[model samples]
Target: MNIEIIEIPKIEDYRGNIAVIENDVVPFEIKRVYYLFDVPSNAKRGGHAHKELFQLLLPLSGSFDVVLHDGENQQKITLNKPDKGLLIKPKTWRELDNFSSGAVCLVISSDVFKEEDYIRDFNEFLEYIR
Candidate 1:
């Protein structure tokens, strides 16, 4: 399992800062864009992994913890800044947790929603990725 944090270059102006995502800036061809926000406490999300789609996740508002496991290997990453995002490659099981109050997560996907492209089970994901 490999995880990488991508730093988005921020440009500061008189009003605020801006970060842009041009095509092919990262890996894979982006086909879908979505965001997760207004997450309530005492709750967890993203207990699945895509079989083919890759994702670049950014914490636009606050912070959160992303726990990843590939059966034998496990790791956790904390995302807290808008200028930085995590690149979740395909075939890696993931779970998002420890969301700070009012944390917002944005995701850029390599493909559209396809049930066959998702590996919803951790054990299954581990086997498939191998």
Candidate 2:
């Protein structure tokens, strides 16, 4: 349950606002950046946990829900702000769903893609955390 909600710095102007994410804003050194977009209303994403990866999920557009578990406790959160992000530490389970239309989720990770680092099974994730 070490999950954190990060507030990205926003620069405001008469025309528009800009949200900035610098290296100092995040706890880890980001090595990858990805996003999920155009997901169907009923479609779901992310039902796994990483062994060592740290991720920050930001709602760039629309809204979505994220469920996080630490093998003993669970929490659910709604992401609807472009200037806020959810930080997920390693060895924690995550599931995402309830996506609104045109929802865009931005993900910043601590490492590149590696299949062996994912724990796709809930039971396995719980066992590994123990």
Candidate 3:
């Protein structure tokens, strides 16, 4: 699995800052958008892999860690900045953990919600990769 950290363009002013993201900024066009917030410290999310969906994750508020596996390799990444994002491709198993207080995770997906597209079982994911 290859994960890319993207630095989005940000405009800063006296009042606040703004980050702009369009279709051309990522490898896949955004088709769905969601966010996770007010999560408990010990809670975890995302324990699955997609067959075709691609995703970009941004830490809009606080911080969290994303653990990725490709059946052969595993990696953990920390997301803490609003201007940065992690681009996740298909066939990579992912787990989100170690969320800080008041953390907000913004996710941009390449496809709409489809239950069949998700590989939720780790054993099934390994078989699919082979």
lDDT score, candidate 3: 0.94
Cα lDDT tens digits, model 2, 11-65, are: 9999999999999899999899999999998988999999999999999999999
What C-alpha lDDT does candidate 2 achieve relative to the native structure?
A: 0.95
Candidate 3 residue pairs in backbone clash? none
Q: Which candidate would rank higher by TM-score, 1 or 2? A: 2
> What lDDT does candidate 3 reach at residue 58?
98
Off by over 4 Å in 1: none
The digit string of per-residue lDDT tens for model 3 on 17-44 reads: 9899987787787789999999998999
Task: Please list the residue runs of candidate 3 whose C-alpha ends up more than 4 Å from where it truly belongs after superposition.
Answer: none
Error of 2 at 115 (Å): 0.7
- CA lDDT of each prediction against the hidden true structure: 0.86, 0.95, 0.94
- TM-scores of all candidate predictions against the true structure: 0.91, 0.98, 0.96
Q: CA shift at 53, candidate 2, in angstroms?
A: 0.3
**lDDT string, candidate 1, 18-105, tens digits:** 9887774668888899999878755788999877778999999999899998667899999998989899987778899888898999
